[model samples]
Target: MGVIDWAIVAIYGVVVIAIGIIASRRQTDTDEYFRGSRQIPWWALGFSIIATSFSAASLLGGPGEGYTNGFLYLQLQLGDLLGYGLVIALLLPFFVRLNLTTAYEYLEKRFDAKTRSLGSLCFLLFVIARLGGLLYAASLVVATVTDLPMGAAILLVGVVSIAYTVVGGITAVVWTDVLQFAMIFVGIGAGIWTAVNGVPGGFGELWQVAAANDKLALFNFSWEPSSVRSLPTALFAYGILAFAVAGTNQQSVQRYVSCADEKSARKAILLGWFSGLVGVGATLLLGVLLFGFYSINGGLPADIAADGILSHFIVNAVPPGASGFLVAAIFAAAMSSIDSALHSLSTCITVDFYDRYVQARTNEKQSLRIAQILIVVWGIVGIGSAFYAASTGKDLLEFLVTYTTMFLGPLLGIFLMGVLFPRVNSSGAFYGTIAAVMLVIVGSNMGWLTFPGIWRSAITAPLGMLLGYGISLFGQIPPQRALQGLTLWHSSKQAQALGRPGLEEEVPDRGDY
Candidate 1:
């Protein structure tokens, strides 16, 4: 890139760091650091959720999926709408009612300390793995453009994220994400305009090219187990992925808990659907455009890998200054996600581990310090993992999509049981979660169980949940007494009556906004 391009990237970086430092003033205590003292507006939080979830995966991976598979890949995203709806309808209310500081805290109250710790551990593992994949992807993009070593790029991204996150906390994360999301859209929009102008036939011609190449089709009706990309498998795998993202994932769930009440939380979730749809849809469309651009240009650069398609395009195709802006945008995507993961992981460790196990007497300031320290530690670990993953030459999308489910699916199953089935005891919930996780691992490794043949992975979590729930019911009697307690929505009402405004009121002892 030209000097102009480098300047654009540098400017974007400065703006992000500035925002974080500004937000840091508001984060004077643990609650404010972790959840922004629940003062963030629904719309801002909704956009932040979109920004966080989009990630480098969506920025690059979505287009890659489209370039290779066509519109049929969209089936996976369809499940998100349903997944978000379920979270709004069911999971949000339950979390709100509990006034949960960490999502795992609910597990502790309903089950046992072991159960809560187990859940937290699972999340911690998933976040580390997933964030490693994200950092790796971002590093690849930067390295591709600037010809830097992958390790250097990875360190640069990790340090920037850790610096802001440790200082500004969740408030910084939310506001910075808003700006990052805008930059991503700007880059994507510019790419799309350029592609459309260059192509002779516009979208119509592009569609024709895709159709001729068998990319326009959206479904494969075959039900046979042998097919890897059939309609059923896509739907089933996507459904599970959606459930994990919306209902079970701590990073996503934490955003809901950051809202003022159950009502606002639900609204934020629903609003996020529009952002998700548009963001994903644009990425996919850009993929089609990328395909046409490369096809007409007589194929991509010889060294361009499948996952590097979008990055390759940005560095080679976009104008000088704009190219750096796009590069910064990629960093923005990675940072948005990593920041959330850091905060969530720290929150889980502090609330679930330090507070519950090590020292019950710790005050809010002490807790915040502990969390900030954990964030730095995890950030280093994430960077190391990114270097390890880069050496494996794994496809970023496949590695992230498959490994994330290893733990998330079982967690989802256990949580579903806990909230939906009041009869389930701590013992049952504990054993049920374990059983579900084992089933997922066994099925994935052995390949004995398969659903929707095109989806190579086994439906372990869903099936395990089914089995675990069934096992729990064998000797347990249903509760004859009505479950007496406030639901998640009603908990908001209780908080309001108690003069909490559900989340708007800042706890004085906690400090800051």
Candidate 2:
């Protein structure tokens, strides 16, 4: 990167910090800090949701997948769309009506305290592990572009993200995400333009090269259960992966809960799908560009390994000033995810743990302080984990991504059992989660659950959910009033009151900056 690129990165950092400081004033209460006082514009929230979900993993990992494996990876996203649709149709209404602060709180309302706490604990572990990987990936991009030490770069990114997240809360996260999303598009567009302009045959030549190398093929339509990358596995297994991510994950669910109502939430979710499709398309295009650039140039630099395609091209292929912008774009991808994780983790700890146990009658000011402090604490933990991951010589991003999925199958199973199977008692849900998680661990160790050849993991959530529900069914009690009490889909005065516009009035909801 040239001096101009450094200037751009410095300016971007300043703008993000300023936004965080400005948003600090709005962090006067727990509700505002956690949910943005339910006042964010649906468009901004929608874009923010896209930005958060499209992490460094998506930006870099997607292209890497394309470069190595072809368009077969896009099949995973098919289930992703279905997952978001399901969330909009089912989960959004339930969360909006209840005015939830954290996603796991729904478990408490439907089951028992133990279920809620267990769910929250799973989310906490997943976010920290995943956020560390995001930070590591962004730091690696910085290291490649600017020739900085990876650990130092990781620390730098972590500190800047934490500075804003601790102050700005949800408001800062959403607004800054809009800017980050724009940066991502600009970077992708610039990369695509450069690729096309430099190539002899343009897009046609690019597609021919990819197809010649077996990178352009999309469908793998086959139903062999043991075949990992077959069409059936990509459609069904990846579908389950998408459902687990969009429907039950705290980070995605929190975005919906922050919306004003179910209608707005639905709109936001639908728009998010469009944003995701555009983002994925751009990422795939970038991969094709990298492939063409390398084929024409007789392959990449020696230091540019299999996983470093995007970073290497942006640094070596793009002009000096443009490299900086691409770096900023990479930073945007990482921060969008890390900041949201920090915000959600803090919210879960504060609302789910501190408020529920530490101080039941705490005032707004005290709640806000606890939340800010927890953000700092979790940020430090993530940074520490990044450093440890770096020293261990493991692929930080891959490790984080795989570890997070280990929890997803179980979490999805627990939630589905609670919501769809009313007979699944608190004990059943709790034990079912343990069993599903154990199966994941055991399967992974036995190599029966290795990551599929495709981009997404192959250990389908449906199998886990079915196993959990099956287990819960055996312990089912006969029809009783207890089942009726557990029915969240049934209407009540509380539900009707929640349906009213002034429901926030009855709750005296305090508010984010």
Candidate 3:
């Protein structure tokens, strides 16, 4: 790489450090550290949410998917759209009204501590386990563009992410996301522009070639759930996953809690819907452009793995200094994601486990200290796990997504049961979760169930919820009267029972929000 490229990367690093220090100054207590003192802007939180939701997978693997599978991958994105609607219509009001610190806290008040711990356990595994895989994927770009070994690259990334997240907490993660989000767009936009123009044709010519090759094809409305990329199956899978991750996962939940009010929280989510649409579009479209680029030249680049197509193009195609920023964009995507996960992991542990079980009486100062320590510990776990990931040699993205979604269906299902179906007691929720997981494991292996691969989450999540719903219907047992505020229809009554503001404040008359 040229000196200018090196300079650009250095500058990016320096600016990130400056951002951490500035944001760090704003945190005076654990509440501000974890929830941004309810001062974060909705648009900013929306941007951060998008940044945290999709990662290097969307930036790199998306194009790779486009290059290899045509537009079949785009169908999965449709399900994610439904998640935002779920958040605005249902989840936003409840979370705001309760003024919860962690999403899992809702579970405890709704059912029991065991259920709350269960939900938190699922969230921790989903997020923490993905970190090592993310580190490995990001290191590919770092190792390609610099002299660092993959291990060292992973360490460097882990260390840098920890530094900012540990010091600035959620505020740093959000604002840096604004910067990283911008980088993602700029990098993807530049790549698309160059790839399209560099090809023998522009949009018209590229579309002709893409159409002929079916690279632009979308929505094969097949009913077979095992159809890996079918519209019906894939859409179903993504919708369930979006609700599980965006609505229930701590990573996304904490962002919602940081809003100044229920209105801002809802507005932020709406903004995220728009930003998410554009961000995903840019990545997917870049994939289409890359397909056209490679096709015009006859085939994939020589001396490159399929996953390295985007990196290969950046190295050989883009200008000098700009390439550094593009690489920075990849790192930006990676850093944004892992830092958010780390912070969320810490929040989940601190609020759900540490605070509740370990030392409920711990003051804010001690809680803040404990949270920072967990950040370091989880960061180490992620870094250490990268060593094992390198040896396993799995497709990092696929590996991460597979495991993350394994329990997602059951987890989201239980929440749905608690919120929407009041008759569903702890036993019903517990048994249904166990049955859903068992069904997924057996079906995935035996091929008895139509849902397979990533599609497992889609079918499995709703199946679990349905199981919970049906099983609870058979019972004459009702939820404890103390559990009223937690259910959707009776949130106000529950509030009255508990002497808190009833469901009225739980959901404001947010006409448009």
- Best candidate according to lDDT: 3
**Predicted structure 1: clash tally:** 6
Candidate 2 residue-wise lDDT, 116-170, digit = tens: 8888888888788787788888888878876889978998889988998998989
Per-prediction TM-score to the true structure, in the order listed: 0.89, 0.89, 0.91
Task: Write one digit per residue (lDDT tens) for candidate 3, span 1-513.
Answer: 688888877888788888889998887789899998888888999899889976875677877777777777767667777777887777877777778889887776666678778888888877767787777678878887786898888888889888888988899999999898998887787787787778666877777877888877777887866654787765676676777888888888888888988888888887877788777767777778788887787777466655688888888888876687788889888888988989999999999889878997999989999999999999999887767676786665577777778756678887888888887866677677778888878876797765456666666767777777677777645544425566777757656776664544432211210
Best by TM-score: 3
Per-residue error (Å), model 1, residue 90 = 1.9
Off by over 4 Å in 3: 200-204, 442-450, 466-480, 493-513
Model 2 CA lDDT for position 24: 81
Q: Roughly what TM-score does model 2 have, to 2 decimal places? A: 0.89
Tell me which of candidates 2 and 3 scores higher on lDDT.
3
